[model samples]
Target: MRRQHLAEEIEEIFRCSGGTYGSPKVFIELVRRGRRVSVNTVAKVMAELRPAGRKVRRRRSLTRPGRRPAPRISSAGTSPPRNRNSSGQAT
Candidate 1:
């Protein structure tokens, strides 16, 4: 009777939402239509219908590997001429 009619209306709303409308959205829509239905009731009906929602796809990484490694620089000072000796000792 009343329950069956409500179930049909819920199904219609679910379809109209591209099958992405879960119980919460359906409950809001039913309320907006002046229907005095509870969210739990809508959720129960939706469970019975089992409409499939859209799945979220994972994003791929944008960074790529470089062919050559970067050159390492000394951290002691800037790129000015060094005052050290050729024997690996400071002058």
Candidate 2:
């Protein structure tokens, strides 16, 4: 549960932060708004008033290459190690 005035501050934080600020940013914003306010109070109020962030959906590509038959390979095993150059890593 949140205090009524704290709820108003949460709304003000959302307005100033443009809905992008989560607890961390909103906490800092609250500190900036007034010297007397503490970050913990802002963080708690923001958590109750608004969601942290919206779920992000990745774009799926339906335009893929047509199905094709697998190719035959003579040896599908790892190749033999080659000589390394001046660098310590393998060539």
Give me the candidate number with maximum TM-score: 1
lDDT of 2 by residue, 45-86 (tens): 666776564334799887667977689766668786688888
- Tell me the spans in candidate 1 whose CA falls farther than 4 Å from its real position: 55-91
Candidate 2, run of 10 with poorest lDDT: 47-56
Tell me the TM-score of model 1. Answer: 0.60
Q: Residue 4 of model 1: what lDDT? A: 94
Total backbone clashes of candidate 1, pairs 3 or more residues apart or in separate chains: 0
Candidate 1's error at 72, in angstroms?
7.6
Top candidate on lDDT is 1
Per-candidate TM-scores read: 0.60, 0.44
TM-score of model number 2 = 0.44
lDDT of 1 by residue, 1-91 (tens): 9889999999899889998877888899999999999999988887887875566579876666575557887678666666888888867
